[model samples]
Target: MSFTDELSTVADPLWDAIEGHPMVERLGAGTLSTDPFEYWVRQDYVYLVDYARVFAYGAGTAPDVARMGTFAELLDSTINTEMDLHRAYAAEFGISEAELEATEASPTTRAYTDFLVRTAATGSFGDLVAVLLPCMWGFNETAERLRERGKPDDERYAEWIDTYAGAEFTELTTWCKELMDDVARDASDAERERYRDLFYESGRYEYRFWDAAWRQEGWEL
Candidate 1:
C-alpha cells in the first residue's frame, strides 16, 4: 500500500477521536469563541516547547553520528521557528517568552511531554515519530481546516489560525509525514500498532490538555 493509504488506515481511530471531540468540532466549524481558542493556543505554546526538547534529545541520542547531526539540525530549526511563532502570538497577548517559559505546564501537558521524551530516549526512531506525528501532523491538518472554514474576524484568532496553517507549518508537517512514512516501511506490524497507539493517545491527551488550560484560573488572552 502507499504511504498515504497506510497513514489513513492507522489514523482512523485518531480521526474518530478528534471528530468526537467537542472542542475540535467547534474549532473546525469556526464557532469557537476567541477566548477558548486563545486559551488553547497559550497552552499549546507551552506544550510545544517541551515537545521540541524531546525531539532535540532524540536527535542527540541517535545511534549514528551523521544521523544525529541531521536530527539535531532539524530539531534546532523546528525549535527556533516555533519559538519565533510563539513570540509573535505572545506579543498580541501581552505575554513574554520569559513568562511563558516560567509558567508550569498543566499536568496533562507535562505528562504527555515527559512521555514523548522518555519514548524518544529509549525507543526506536519509528517509535519517536509515532509519538510526535500526531501533534505535528494532526495539528497542521486541523489548523488548515480551521483556516479554510474561516478564522474568527478577531485579530488574535486570525493570528493563531494563521500561525499553524501558514506555509512554514505546511512544510514542517510535510517533512514529518515523509519521515514517518519512510520509517514505517520497514516496521513490523506490532511496531506499527505501537506507533499508531502513540499517535492516538497523544492526540487524546492534546484535547485534555486544552480543556484543562481553558479551565485554569485567569487564563485570559
Candidate 2:
C-alpha cells in the first residue's frame, strides 16, 4: 500500500469525522450560516499566509529543480490564486481587504499553523511533507466527497464547495500524493512511522480547525 493508504488505516476515523463534520454537511446542503463561513474564510486566509511559507520552505529544501518548481508554483498560487478566492469571499461578506489582512488567528488556527511552520522551518523534506500532506489531501478529499452528493443551489456555499472538489484541486491532491509516495518509497521504517504519526496529527488538527469555526472558538482572555 502507498504510505497515504497505510496512514489512512490509522487515520480513517478522523478523516471520516472531518468529512462528516456538521460544518461540512451544512455547506454541502447549502443550509450553512454565513457567519460561520465568514469566520472560516477569515481564519483560513491567515492560515494560508503561513501556508505559503511552508511551500517556500519545501522549494528551498527540495533536492531537484522539478520538485522545487512544483513547490514554487504552489507558493505562487497560494499568495496569488488561492488568496484571490478568499478576497472574493471576504467581499461577499462586506469584509474589506484591510480587515482580512488584519484578521486574527483563533487558538486552533494558531496552533495548527504554528505546527506547520515549525515543521517546515526545522524538519527534513520528508518531515515537512509528512505534516503538509494531510491539508493538501484532506481538503480535496472532503470537497470531492461532498461534491459527490451533488451540487447545491445555494450561492453562499456553492463556490466554497466547488473550489475544493473542482478539477484543479483534485489534480493538486493527486500531485501531493505522488510527492509523499516518492519519499515513502525509500523511507526507513522508523521514518515511515514518524510520517504516519505526523499525518495523523495533522488530520486531527484539520478536524479541529473546522470544529473551531463551527463553534466560533476563540482564546478567552
Candidate 3:
C-alpha cells in the first residue's frame, strides 16, 4: 500500500482524537483567530533555525555514510522549502530576520525541536520518522482543513493558512508519510507503537501551542 494508505490505516485513531478536540473546532471555526498566529509564526521561524542545525547533525552522523548523502539532500531540501519559506512568512508579518534569530523559542518549541534532533542523531531511521511524521502530517492536515474552511478569505489569516496549505508543504508531508510507510512495512510492533505515540504526542503539543498562543497577553492585535 502507499504511504497515504498506510497513514490512514495506522494513524487514523490518533487523528480522530485530535480532530475531536474542542480546540480544533475553535481553531477551524475561526473562533480562536488572533494576533498570536503572527506571533507564533515568528516564534516558529526561530525554532526552525535550531531544526535546521539538528537536521545538519543528522546529515553528518548517519551510520550508513551514504545515508549521510540522503540526509544532506533531505536537510537541504527541508531548509530551502520549510525554513526559507518561514523566513518569507516572517517578512510578510513585518518581522525581521534579526528579530527572529535573536528571539528565544518557547519551552514547547524547544522541547519539540530538541526531540527531533535527538531522534535524528541517535535513533534508527524508523525512530526519526516516528518523531517527524506527526509534525508534517498534522500541520498539513490542519492547514488544509483551515484553508478549505475559508480561512484564506480573511485578510488577517490568509497568509498563515496559505503557507502550510501550499503544494510544497503538502508534498513534504506526503514524502514523509511515504518514508514512514516504507519503514512500517517491516517494523516491529514496538516500533509501530512508537510512531503512533509520537503522532499523538505531537498533535497534542500542536493544540497546546495554539491554545497558549491564543491566550497569551496582547494576543488581540
Candidate 4:
C-alpha cells in the first residue's frame, strides 16, 4: 500500500469519529439547527482564511515550480472559489462579507487553524500533506456520504452539502491525495511515522471542530 493509504488504515478510528459525528448526522437528516450552523459559518469563514495561507506556505515550501504552481492554484481556488460559497451562504444568513471577514475565531477555530499554520511553518513540505489531507479529503468523504443519504430540504443547507459533494471538490481531494502519496513515497521510515502522528493529531482537531460547531462552543466569559 502507498504511504497515505497506510496512514489512512492506521488513522481509521479518528477519521471515523469525524465522519460519524453528531453534527454531521444532524446535517444529513435536515434536523440541524440554524444557530449552530450559523456559528459554524462564522467560525469557518475565518477558518478558511487561514486555511488558504497554508496553501501559500505549501507554494513557498515546494521543491519545484510545478508544485508551487499547484499550491498557487489551490490557494486561489480557496480564496476565490470556496470563500465565494461562504459569502453566498452568509448572505442567506443576512450577514455581509464585512461581518464574515471580521469574525473572531472561537477557541476551537483558533486552535484548529493555529495547529495547521504551525505545522506548515515548522515542518517539511511533506508534513503539510498529513496536516491538510484530512481537511480536503475528510470533508469530501463526509459530505459524499451525506449526499448519498441526503437530507436538507433547505436550499441553504443543501447548497452546503452539494458543494462538497460536487465534482470540483472531489477533484480537489484527489489532487491532495496524490500530493500526499508523493510525499509519503519519498519519506524516510522515521518521517513517515511522524507524518502518521501528524495525521492523527490534525484529525483529532477535525472531530472536535464539528463538536464545537454543534455546541457553538466558546470560552466561558
Candidate 5:
C-alpha cells in the first residue's frame, strides 16, 4: 500500500469518529445550530492564520525547489484565497472582519495549530507533510462523504461541502498524498513509524477541533 493508504488504515477509526461527530453530521444535514457554527468559524479563522505559517515553514524546509514552490503557493492560497472565503462566511453570520481579526483561539484550536507550527519549524520536511496531510485529506473525505449523501438544504453548508469536495481541493489533497508517499519511499522504518505517529496525533487533534466547536469549549480560569 502507498504510505498515505497505510496512514488511512491506521487513522480509519479516528476519521470515522470525526465524520460521525454531531457537528459534522448536522452540518451535512443542514440542521446544525448557528451558535456552534459561529464558534467554529471564529476558531478556525485563527487556526488558519497559524496554518499558513506552517506552510511557510514547509517552504523554508523543503529539500527541492519544486516542493518549496508548492508550499509557497499553498501559503499564498491559504492567506489570500481561503481566508477571504472564511471572512465572507463569517460575514454571513454577522461576524465583522474586525471581529474575526480579534477572535481568540480556543484551547483546541491553539493546541492543534501550535502542534502543527512546532512540528513544521523543528521537524524534517517529511514530518511536516505527515502532520499536514490530515487536515486537507480529512476535510476532502468528509466533504465527499457529505456530498454522497446529497447536498444539504442549507446553502452555506452546501457551499462548504462543495468547497472541500470540489476539484481544486481534491487536486491539492492528491498532491499531498503523493508527496507523503514520495517522502516515505526514502525513509527508514523508524522514520516511517514516527511519521505514522505524527499523522495519527494530527488526526486526533482534528477530531478534537470538531468536538470543541460542538461543545463550544472554553478554558476555565
Candidate 6:
C-alpha cells in the first residue's frame, strides 16, 4: 500500500468518529444552529491566519522546487483567496471583517494552530506534510460524503459542501497525499513512525475542532 493509504487505514477509526460527530452531521443536514457555526467561523478565521503560516513554513521547508512552489501557491491562496471568501461568508451571517480580525482563538483553536505551526517549524518537511494531511483530507472527505447525501437545503451550508467537494479542493487534497507518500518513501522507519504519530495526533485535533464548535467551547476560567 502507498504510505498515505496505510496512514488512512490506521486512522480510519478517527475518520469515522469525525464523520459521525454531531457538528458535522448537523451541518450536513442543514439543521445546525447559527450560533455554533458562527462561533466556528470566528475561531476558524483566527485559525486560518496561522494555517497560512504553516503553509509558509512548508514553502521554506519543502525538499524540491516543485513542492516549494506548490506550498507557496497554497500560502498565497489561503491568505488572499480563501480568507477573502471566508470574510464574505462571515458577512452573510452579520459578522464584520473587524469582528473576524478581532476573534480570540478559543483554547482548542489556539492549541490546534500551535501544534500545527510548531510541527511545521521544528520538524522535517515530511513531518509537516503528515500533520497537514488531516485537515485538507478530512474536510474534502467530509464534504464529499455530505454531498453524496445530496446538498443541504440551507444555501450557506450547501455552498460550504460545494466548496470543499469541488474539483479544485479535491485536486489539492490529492497533491498533498502524493507529497506525503513521496516523503514517506524516503523516510527511515523511525521517521515514518514519528510521521504516523503526528498524523494521528492531528486527526484527533480535527475531531476536537468540530466538537469545540459544536459546544462553542471556551475557556472556563
Clashes of 6: 0
Identify the runs in model 4 with alpha carbons over 4 angstroms from their true place: none
List runs of model 5 lying over 4 Å from the truth.
none
Regions of candidate 2 where Cα sits further than 4 Å from its true position:
none
Better structure of 2 and 4 per TM-score: 2
Residue-level lDDT of model 3, residues 1-221, one tens digit each, is 55447556645665665555554555566664546666666667766676666657766655567657765876787667766666776787787878877766776676777767777778777777666677668777877777776764455356556767788778878777776777787888787777766655665666555555555423232
- Writing each residue's lDDT as its tens digit, candidate 5 over 34-76 gives 8999898899899999999999999999999999999999999
* Model 4 lDDT tens row, 137-170: 7788888888888657977778888999899999
Give me the overall lDDT of model 4.
0.87
* Reference-based lDDT, each prediction: 0.70, 0.89, 0.66, 0.87, 0.92, 0.91
| Residue pairs with backbone overlap in model 2 | none
lDDT of 3: 0.66
Q: Which residue pairs of candidate 6 clash?
A: none
Question: Which tens-of-lDDT digit does each residue in 1-221 have in candidate 2?
Answer: 78878877766787689878999899988888888999999999999999999999999999799999999999999999889999999998899989998998999999999999998999889989988888978888787788889878897677877888788888888888888989999999999888888888888899999999999998798
Measure candidate 5: CA RMSD. 0.8
> In order, what is each prediction's RMSD in angstroms?
3.7, 1.0, 4.3, 1.2, 0.8, 0.9
Per-candidate TM equals 0.81, 0.97, 0.75, 0.96, 0.98, 0.97
Q: Higher TM-score: candidate 1 or 2?
A: 2
Sort order, TM-score high to low: 5, 6, 2, 4, 1, 3
Off by over 4 Å in 1: 10-38, 61-70, 217-221
> What digit string (tens of lDDT, one per residue) describes model 6 on residues 1-221?
89988887767788788879999999999998999988888888899999999999999988789889999999999888778868988998888999898998899999999999999999988899999999899889989989998888998789889888999999999999999999999999999999999999998999999999999998888
Candidates 2 and 6 compared by lDDT, better number: 6
In lDDT terms, which candidate is top? 5
User: What is the TM-score of candidate 2?
Assistant: 0.97
Candidate 4 or 1, higher lDDT: 4
